[model samples]
Target: MLRSDDLQVFVLTAELGSLSAAARQLELSPAVASAALKRLEAQLGCRLLVRSTRSLRLTGEGELYLPHARSALQSLVEGQQLLAGGKATISGTLQLSAPSDFGRNVLLPWLDEFQLQHPLLSLRLLLADRNADLFRQPVDIALRYGQPEDSSLVAVPVAAANRRVLCASPGYLAANGSPRTLADLVHHNCLRFMLAGRVHERWCFLDDRHRELEQLVSGDRVSDDADVVRRWALAGRGVVYKSWLDIAQDVQSGRLVVLLPELLGEPTPLNLICAHRAHLGERVRLLREHLVERCQRLIQLAPFAH
Candidate 1:
């Protein structure tokens, strides 16, 4: 039998052209990855790869064995999925990625509940504001905001009612007074956040006449982390434009107050993105549905949830 690690090391080394890169992707040291490949070749009694400092190329045996190894791996994964499919209890690691704020505030507890329900299942979550490369990264699932840029990925809508909401803490509002109009925001402290690498100073909204409005608002404070921005808002630092799901509890509990009630924020989608549709197990599909259903309920419960 081809050991899973050996098979993976061979496939990844061939695909990535660098033993170090494949090793890092698998969270194994370069020494271990090299040893695994050597073990595989020793067992097969053939040289599969020609390696040098600059490059790694597959030999004739590797060229022939590559497809079969990949196919075999796929088969094993599918068979495991089939065995676990629709079972009352499901088991296996579910690797997921999400935005930092959403992952910490919203998805963390939700995942906890999921974990409790399926004790056999394991979870690996990576939280970052930037989108993960599904092909290179080990993540099997990701939750994100807005349109998925990668055309190759399959995006499932977790919720369509996602709209930005302008909020400020009660103390800040008391000190700075609520803005009565879009023009009024310029005078107020409008907190800014950075996504990826760009600073998001421009905010979009619909005016009372149902016309689109965009403003490049500035503030005394800025942060790369959305959670930091939210915390600042909660601390009465400044007004922030953010998704309703993020500040639902704050809005409901009166920690933050929604401003400019008549103006509607632009729509953004909350999506469940995956690399491809093939071999997606029933567990993944169920989890998608579960998120959508729960998010819908949360939107319903949130006082001013878009």
Candidate 2:
């Protein structure tokens, strides 16, 4: 029989590319980690790693076995979670990624409340403007706006009705005046943000006849960080096209006013996304439900501009 500890050691070492580093992560000594690896090899009757003083690399056999090892570990974990009644067994670290604006202004407090509910669970949050690569990065889940372009990933809708809204600070509108028509945006300073290394300068809208309209927009300021653009708008620098969920509080509080209330802005539904269906543990399910409720309530509170 293969010991779970030995399997864990092998997987960690393979992933980290350092036996000592894996041991440190597992809170075990280097000797124990080495022994576990040797014992695993003895059971498998093959050397998994080609170790050297300078580096560690997987052999051909190890390369073939690594995916199987990961699958086995995942299965074991899922089995444990299932037997523990899911939510009650949610005890491990839940690594999540989100857009910087939402993560700080919105999710930070929500997660704090969630942690309080599940005292046994731990959380690790990564905040970035770009999409997190679930396969390459250590993130387990992510909260994102707009439909995922990757068909392989599983996306659970948190706010299907959510849409992008054209907005500006009261101060900015006061100084520069408001855009009454889609064409009027070209005359205004439209704050822009970068997505996937490209500046999102094209703004989309729906006409009063429900026809699609596209406008080429530019601004005095641009930022990769969505929150920075929101700040710039708030500072009376330019107009911002943003997710309604991200600026709900600001809009509700009368800080940011919605600009073209008649025309429909582009839909940008929010989703709780993960790389695989198997990764949807009980904690994720509960968190999704919690977020759905919170998001819907806020959406209801915001003035419908689009």
Model 1 lDDT on a 0 to 1 scale: 0.82
lDDT of each: 0.82, 0.85
- The worst-scoring run of ten residues by lDDT in candidate 1 lies at 276-285
Question: What's the lDDT for candidate 2?
Answer: 0.85
Candidate 2 per-residue lDDT, tens place, 169-286, comes to 9998888888888899989999999977899999898877999989999877888999899888888898998988899999988899998877778888889988777677677888
On residues 188-237, what C-alpha lDDT tens digit does candidate 1 reach at each position?
99989987779999899987688999988999998888888999999999
Cα deviation at 159, candidate 2, in Å, is 1.5
Per-model TM-score on C-alpha atoms:
0.77, 0.86
